[model samples]
Target chain A: MLDFTGIEKERLRARWVSSAEAPEFVEEVNAFIDTLKELGPSPLKAAVEAKKEEQKEAPA
Target chain B: MIETIKQHVAGLLTEKKIAGFLGLIEKNGHVAPHLFKDGESLAGFTLGDRKTAGDARYPLNKTLVTLSRAYPEETFGVLVRGCDERGLYGLFRLNQLTEDRVIPVGFSCPAELSEACECRKPYPDSLVAGEKTESSQLKKVAEMDGKDLARRFDFWTAQFVKCVKCYGCRDVCPMCFCKECSLECEDLVAKGDLPVEVPVFHLTRAMHMADRCVDCGLCDEACPSDIPLRLLYKKTAQIMDTDYGFTSGLNKNERSPLSQMGPAK
Candidate 1:
């Protein structure tokens, strides 16, 4: 729903299912996991991890 | 022009039409906001020559709000350019001050001054000094509008990374009178994070400014990082105008659709 681009757009998904539609919810979750696998790790998370590593190596 | 303004203010003070006049004064080789009371002190009032415009532009409306809140019963006159007058109108809509309690002495800006600000309206409706000139749109916003979504996103993300989270923009904004700002909220924006969260901090501010921003460009001037904040807020104003048919600070009686509770008419 946000103005994200390329793989960033694939990183998020939303679906509405009734309480009785357990099969549909499961299918949606699986589809989201497959999409996540295809897209690999999130760029924002990678950037944060890299910053944390840099701080760890920095001299006091 | 300065003499004319001085005389006008002196007349107001002598006639007791206002308890004080809020305007600029030259002191210690600098110009700053001062409250002029007695007619005799009108000689000290100044418009601050063209050269001082860059450094001398103060949030006179914000000062007026503070003074009025303190006094409550007193009336005051203020020297206003186009931007300040727009701010007053916005404040009046927000119920910060009533129209009857404050009088505005308006003036126009020169072409060079207007060009520097990328101002769309450099003269107030009640102009008493200087001739009204054509307003200019910001060239940067126009250029950015033609770029692809990805390219525009990249440009904004790069600019947002430069932010030091100073909050100078909010402090200098005349319309930002909210006692509790979302920017300070720990949920929306985390505390003690360098560079702040990308796009969230700014986007939140942009959303808040959409209905209220008068396009004064003060936030742009106050930004230490030169982040082109005015351009972003100007785009928000454009969006509001296109989607909701609302223009801030234009009509005192008309309320922005976003501020109204019911469905838009």
Candidate 2:
């Protein structure tokens, strides 16, 4: 799992990339897509199930 | 601000650069977002104080998303304040817009707005005019963090009770691009009452905000009930920060945690 701490430290680097740099933007985004290849599918099932149980326990 | 924006607007249109520009226009002493076509009369184009609008939420973000989808081939420029710029970034991440098709005319908001909205960066990467200033806004999330759990619950409950169900919150949100909303989901939130009962409606909105909300405060402004929806979403953002250490709309390259899974390879 990726450490959550490093995420905020990452700077939002934005420049005035022109239409001519469209290819560069595409390449950069595509490269970013490759980095997240290992995180796999969302782990929301457990979270959602726990939430439902908690909701059931709490008075509605 | 309006005079400078007008000159820029006139220049862009005269150059035949963009099909239309989106910005606030003074309408009956209230500021509302309007699509300004190149040749249209410019009399109505003026920026007004957001506070006097009564309805704090500016629908510019929603307008851009809708227009971008409707006219994909045409180029559109928008006068984006910091919040609007973040909203645009969120829309871009969702594939609602491409970088080349939209021009973000950054306008540095006054300190009052930045403080009121608790804004971090009051400038965009590319700006047309105005100097960036230090933000004086208090982070509501930080304030809420000081409160006890019971107090937080009571605070939100009382706020939610005022909702008029105007749907202006969702309607004005730049990130709320979905045709069908979870708030309208039959299984989750009930639809009849104004200011939905307790956790269902607001919590549902909060859950959806996990990695989605950009903290624009437009939702809070749009709410007729004056609910601090931004605080709840900010809390959710803070939680995401705990596990994922990420915030929304700051990075154009980062894929939202909710939309994608795995490492940042």
Judging by lDDT against the true structure, name the best candidate.
1
Which segments of candidate 2 are over 4 A away from where they belong?
A1-60, B50-57, B136-138, B193-195, B263-265
Taken over the whole model, the C-alpha lDDT of each candidate is 0.80, 0.68
Model 2, residue B264: C-alpha shift (Å): 8.9
Query: True interface contacts reproduced by each model, as a fraction?
Result: 0.03, 0.00
lDDT of 2 by residue, B1-265 (tens): 6678788887887787889888778788767778888778778775545554223446576787779779989888888777677777877787878878988877777766677677767766556777885765446666776766545544555555556677788877778877798778767667685436454566667777777788878787667767778877877777777778777876666677777678642
Per-residue alpha-carbon lDDT of model 1 for A1-60, expressed as tens digits?
A: 124211266766878899999999999999999999987875654454454455458622
Off by over 4 Å in 1: A1-60, B50-55, B262-265
Output the worst ten-in-a-row residue range by lDDT, candidate 2 chain B: B48-57
Model 1, residue B42: C-alpha shift (Å): 2.6
